[model samples]
Target: MLLELAGIDKQVGADTWLYPLNLTLQESAVTILLGATRAGKTSLMRIMAGLDTPTTGRVLVDGQDVTGVPVRRRNIAMVYQQFINYPSMTVADNIASPLRLSGQRDVLPRVREIARTLHIEEFLDRLPAELSGGQQQRVALARALAKDAPLMLLDEPLVNLDYKLREDLREELGDMFSQGRSTVVYATTEPAEALLLGGYTAVLDRGELLQYGPTIDVFQRPNSMRVARAFSDPPMNFIEARADGAALHCQGMGPVPLSGSNLPSGAVTLGLRAADLSLQHQGGDCLISGQVQLAEISGSATYVHAQTPVGNLIAQVPGVSHHQLGDAITLHFSSRQAYVFGPDESLLRAPQMEARHGSY
Candidate 1:
């Protein structure tokens, strides 16, 4: 492991903000930390970078305990969400500031090389105030890269850029990490960002580590509804449910067939992602009736929002869709696509669900 945290905890003003958390970031791979605002993602990154002292537990890098080390001595580079630059200095000076502070004499050539890599070589003589927001961000990244640190901590580095610029920067950053083989701990509130930079993903809720594992595994098999909902764009659709003697009963989905016999009876939550829901010509097994409330078409696909007895649900259909607003549609799902959660909001991996459904 390149970076590791065990039993980590943090608090502020007598209130326990973050609970015990553990994470292992592999060398040469990117670990994206994902959560909503105020989930303590930044705090965790700060602790790992030695910027903030942990209230308890330990922080280890390459099997070395550096928990109490100061930020300057940790040898980690951080790219913050905001653009922190010397407004009065040129881009070249900003990138070389760290090397000069460390008393390194031969730094200009290295700074130039990093600038070229980040595609900012031409703007080296321009002051930060004269550059665009994206350019300034690239300069910050170049400075971090020039440091040649073993670990890189990026806190929402692409949040401030426009859509196209953010995409381009994401690709560039991915390439940089691949070339350097540097361990990275990235913090982002976007699910797409986490999936784009595929690696270990840790979901945080109220400072607690909810689930951490391979990105695909966590997205496909979320531990709970909360974790599952976190990965969706508009979020997952939830509906009340009950387990019949041998069927799972939902208000709109009807009684879905169960493959096992030991299902707990009572109220449950049914979760279905927008991508998992489909429109069908007729009602069949696991079919739900709903009226289209809105339709959004974007290039090759269309998103249909429907109003059903259970609640509002969104479905993504490939290519152009024929459905229109106020049209009654039949929504279908394979037993495999349905995720059932207990009343306590914990995931219920019923044997019947797994045994019957293979795609979910």
Candidate 2:
């Protein structure tokens, strides 16, 4: 492991910030810390970089305990959301700042190499004030890469960029990671970004580590309802239900046969993803009828928002459909695709359902 954090905890003022957190970043892999704002993503990055110390636990880098090491002495590079560059200095000089600060007298070649790799070579002679925001950020990244550190921490590096530039830079960063063994710990709240990077993703909520695993495993088999909701776009749909003998009863889809046991009597929330719900011409098993309230067309596919007896739900339909608002339609889903959550909102695995039916 390039970076390891064990039993980490922190507090500020009245709130207990980060809970007992543990994570490891492997060499040449990109580990994304995903969560919403104020989830302590930035705080954890700062702790790992040696800028801040936790009230408990230790931080190890390449088998060395560096919990008390100062930020300047740590061999780690951090690129923040804000473009930190000297307005008076040219791009080349800005990229060379870290090398110069480290007492490396001959730094021009390394600076040029990093600039070229990040595609900012042409803007080397331009000052920070003369370049665009994206260019300035590239300079910041170039500076970070120039250090050739063992670990790179990025805090929403593409926050301010337009969609096109963000996608381009994402690809560039992926390529850069492929060429080296540097460990990367990127923080973002976007689910698509986490899936695209393809590594271990730790979902943080209110400073606590909720779920951590491979991106595919976490997305396909979420440990809890909260983890499932956090990973989806519009989030998973929850319908209050009950188990009646071998069938499950809900307000929308009533009396669907249950494939598992150990269900409580009062109330249970059933979760289904948008992709799991589809429009069916003829009603089949596990079907629910609803009125389309809204329709969103996004080029290749259309998203239909319908008002069901349970609540408002979203369904992803392939290509453009003839469905319109106020239209009555039937939404279909398999029993296996439905997830059952306890009253406390934790996911409950149904082994019988898994064995009887396949996932969509």
Model 1: per-residue Cα lDDT over 202-300, one tens digit each:
988778889988776777777887787776765778888897655688765567766555468888877887767888643444777889999888656
What's the lDDT of the predicted structure labeled candidate 2? Answer: 0.80
| Off by more than 4 A, model 2 | 99-119, 244-247, 254-267, 280-285, 297-302, 318-325, 350-360
What is candidate 2's lDDT per residue for 43-156, written digit by digit as tens? 999999999999899998888899999998877899999989988989988898889988999888898888887778899899999988987888888888887677889998
All candidates: TM-score: 0.85, 0.85
Q: What is the C-alpha lDDT of each candidate?
A: 0.80, 0.80
Candidate 2, position 201, lDDT:
82
RMSD of each: 4.1, 4.2
